[model samples]
Target: MTDQSAAPDATPRPLDHLAAMGAPDALALVDRAGALSFTGLDRAVGALARALDGRGLAKGARVASWLAKTRLASLLPLACARAELVHVPINPLLKRGQVAHILQDSGASLLIAGAGRSGTLEAGDRPADCALLIEDEAGAASLAAQDGLPASAADPDALAAILYTSGSTGRPKGVMLSHANLWLGAVSVAHYLRLTADDRTLAVLPFSFDYGQNQLLSSWAAGACVYPLDYLTARDVIRAVDKHEITTLAGVPPLWVQLAEADWPEATAGRLRRITNSGGRLPVPLVHRLRQLFPAADLYSMYGLTEAFRSTYLDPALIDTHPDSIGGAIPFAEVMLVRPDGGLAATGEPGELVHAGPLVAQGYWQDAERTALRFRPAPVFSKYGGMAVWSGDTAVMDADGLLRFVGRDDEMIKTSGNRVSPTEVEEAAVATGAAAEAVAIGVPDDRLGEAILLVVRGDPAGEGALRDGLKRDLPNFMQPREIRWRADLPRNANGKVDRAGLKAELTS
Candidate 1:
């Protein structure tokens, strides 16, 4: 066990992260609009902060942004923190129901969104008190505003952002991140990845993702410029990389597969200095193909949960030799494999991957019941000596102290580099009135990593209604690849849906 809290919490506030790096004239950000220098980005952040502060929001009030990867969306995270508010970034891909849930659960006082998305919300979709602001130049604060606030001197452990992610059997929970968590995580990833000012990162993932948000924060920490892209196709990514001369790229497994098979000019493929993977494990064959295609770039395979931000990451040097490992503990993180007896697992023994340290998130927002179930005091053997995130993920540490991916303790379905709750899908399926009983199952798919197979105990004719209803209620990723209709469904001893039995039958 490493000394998790050996150093006191001296981490800088997230807003100050901007002021410390990047010279005034150096390039800082690139978007569809144009490039902005470090000085220009700093001023924009300050102006946005001043505008948000001018609003009559109380300190620590929840300020949510549900727009695309626009300039306002990009600047809101740090801007909210500087104004002593918590930012809740809703995934733009989510529909109205999911958006409404977040607004109600987070008690968001204000929502800034584009008309395209804001129009999707009807009647009760928005909370009674949640005010709305347009996302354009006149709607919210514009980039050309003035009176930017200086770097903040706020508490390092105060809430900075609330990132909502799905759990195994419940509605999406908002993972509360503090300034220290975000700062230390950025510094750790930048140091391990050896980021530098000259590096250019093409951020293709959503800012709502923990790892995705880190791309911006970590790049800023290293004084590197960031190019944020919201792409609809793989070719868009290729074009962006070529246009921006990007050095860093981060994606999940499903995307890696697409890129590996993508036709890239030799020069374009070699431009990447580093590629990082999260969201899911990469197949060995996929890893080999990536190595063959981008031999010059370092590949990092990382594993993390929202509760802790991140845990283990494979060293680029060991990728070929030990391709399956999730590596060991990251900086400021002490990852331990604890057996059922609350004792540390011996080498080669399966145990839950428990992460202890400052990088741990504060916990889910306003859900004390679930919070206690996930966040608890560290084991008596812990050196961190505080609450640790019991990941509920099983893994085995090799004698070399390297950890390998095992399985999740729950039936959470991971598809397209995002975690999906089977319960949410089942609930939506039944809500369509297409099924008397519904069971959402995740089956292995070479393309999607895992394809959703929704089984329903309803009329075969109801399949159309089921698919259409799910389309409205759930995101595309949550839609079932196949809907299996049955006259009757299996049941457990307690007479509830036997999910284990269904999964067993399908896999068997």
Candidate 2:
């Protein structure tokens, strides 16, 4: 782990602090059309912040944005942070019910939505007191015409944003993040990544995601430019990289898979200095292929969740020998493996990963019971009764202290009374040329209580041979009872495997 003292104190407020960046004329944001310099972005954010405040909304009130990756949506977070209001970004793809749920849950006094998305809010019955601001010509003219208002001074502990999780099990829960929490997270990531003012980051992930949002904040903190690309195809990514001279890009495994197969321009790829992966681990084969493609860029395999933002990251240098390892605790965090009995696990022992330090979130919004279950005190040490996120992820540490992810605790399949990691099954399946991707689930069985079922995407003709090969790799009990091949596995909006959807398919 890097020494904390060596880390730079890069925390700054979203509004005024960022405006003071040394090179204000440097590009800060880039869209398909053009780029916004630091000075230009600050002016726009200030105008928006004033416009939001002039509408009679008080400090600490919620302001929701339901739009695509437009310049306004990109600026709203910082603008809201400046006004001391919590910004809630609704996923544009969400249905009316989901959008309404977020609006109600956040208690947003006002909503700033694009014309298309505004209908979702307008059609739904909302609180009578709530005001709506449509992001249209009229709204833009209104904002442009409005006079400036004083910036709201915010404490570091004030609520900055309320990001909603996917809520695969139930209703999405809002994750409360303070300015301090976000600032610290950004600083931690920036310090470890060694971000600089010359860096240009291509933003592909949704701003609603914690990891995605950090790409903007950390880059801004380092006075770097962020090109927000709402790409329709892999070609869009390839084009944007070359067009903007992009240096950094963050993506999930699915995006990486797509990019790896896409016809990438050598000139465009040559400009990228860094590429990051999270949401899920990049398959070892895919990681190697990416390394081969972008020989000049540093490939970062990171592991994180909304609850803690980011936990571990495998350095680019170690990708060859430890492709499976998720690496160690990032700057400002201490990650440990705790056994089921609440003791620290020995080296190479699998246990729940407990993340301690300032990076832990306040808790799940309005769900104290669930919050208590996950966030608890640090068992190994306590300086200020600090809370640790008891991540449901199972991990093992090697002698050198690098952590390898085993599986999610809830995702562990029990077959014949033995716990098995679905990821292990999936990894083995993907290793064979027969499958491009795989997911394993334990289905109900009269004899064994549960039986393993495999869902795969591959050539149908080779699936039979792949099943035989899987049996050879796995034990008799661990071998899947059923093998179903699909053209492609179902993915959620964030591009993660929709296990719930997969399970539904099995029952249907």
Candidate 3:
């Protein structure tokens, strides 16, 4: 295993670093609609931050966003960081109920949403005390015409954002990240990825996700352009890459599968210099296919969590021989394998993957019980006494220090790059009143990599109604792709649903 050490002088915030680059005229963000230069982006963010401050929301108060990957969403975090308010980005695909839970849980005072998405917030039944700000209006000249408010002085250790992770309970837990945590994560990723001023990145994932948000931070920190696209087809990605001459593209395994299947022009493929995979591991066949398609790009296979932002990444050079390995720790962080007995595991031994160092988040917001369970004291031989994220993911480190993912220690299902809780789906299914008992399992899917499969013991007559009920209760990604009628779900000796056995039934 690699020796654990600290990085020297990791002090610069992402926005401050970018502002100091002195390339204000360079492209910063682009979409199918248009582009924003660095100068334009800075002015817009400044105006929005000032506007948010003028609303009298206290510093460190959570400002939630329910929007797509628009320029406003791209710039919200930076503005929040400057104003010393925590930005809570709600996934645009999330249902109103889920959005309401996040808003209430975070106690967000100001909510910024798109003009069309206002109905979602209204339907969520949030408290009347919360103020609503439209993204379109905030970006317009009228809001900018108001007086500029001074930026709030914030400590680096203060909370910046609360990202909710899918949990076994019906409710999601917020992963608390500080300014220093996010800033260092951006620096580490940018340094290891070799992002540069001339590079342009394509962003397909939502900013609500940790890995997805880093695409904006790291690229901008390097003074590079980030093109955010909401793609509907593989052809859309190809067109975006060619149209923008994108040098970097980050995606999950499902996206890689689609891209590998879609025919790409030789000229378009040659322009992409880096391809990053996270959210889930890419199969060997898909990895080889991607290598063949983008011969000029370096492929990086990464593994991480919302709590730590990132853990390990397999180097592009090792793809040929160790395609499945989730390599060693990136710069500014330390990853360790802790055995069940609460001791360090030897090489080749399976254990819980432990992440320690600067990138570690503050903990779960307002959920002390869960936070205390996951975030604990660092094991012996650590320089700092801060909390280390005990990722409930089984892994093993090779003698050469490369980490390989085994499986989840918890019963969480990662489908379509979103971490979903089977219990959450089952609860929603049972709540529909059609199912006497329900079990949700992730079955392998060609398009999503993993799709939710619901096994229900219910009236066959109500199956259609139950499906419709789930649609209203869950996000598009959380909804089951298929529903199977069963007399009863398989159970273990403890009487709980045997998710593994259920998954096997579908796959076998």
Candidate achieving the largest TM-score: 1
Q: Give candidate 2 misplaced runs (Cα > 4 Å).
A: 1-6, 10-16, 121-125, 145-152, 382-385, 411-508
Best by lDDT: 1
lDDT by residue (tens digit), candidate 2, 1-508? 1123475664545443554353778888887547788887777777888877777788889988888888888888788887777888776655555577778777889888887767644555456667888888898777762444344467777788898864324456788888877877877777677678888889888887788888888888778888897888999999889987999999877678788989887877889899998877677888889998998998888888777779889888898888878999887677888899998899989999888776778888778987888888888553434888888889999998899998766765644334456776787688677888989887866445467899988888987778777765555656888888889889999999999888877867
Better of 2 and 3 by lDDT: 3
Q: Which ten residues in a row have the lowest lDDT in candidate 3?
A: 1-10
C-alpha root-mean-square deviation, each candidate: 2.8, 10.6, 3.3
In model 1, which runs have C-alpha deviations exceeding 4 angstroms? 1-10, 140-144
Model 2, position 394: C-alpha lDDT score: 93
Per-residue CA lDDT of candidate 1, range 317-433, in tens?
Answer: 999998989998877898998999999999999999898898999999999988999999998898897999998999998888899989988899999999999988998899899
Q: List the candidates' TM-scores in order.
A: 0.97, 0.79, 0.93
Give the TM-score (vs. native) of candidate 3. 0.93
- Flag the better candidate by lDDT, 1 or 2: 1
Question: Clashing pairs in model 1?
Answer: none
Clashes of 2: 0
Q: Which digits, one per residue and each the tens of the lDDT, describe model 3 over residues 64-144?
A: 988888767887888887767899999888877778888888998977787787775564467677777776744454346
Q: How accurate is candidate 3 locally (lDDT)?
A: 0.82
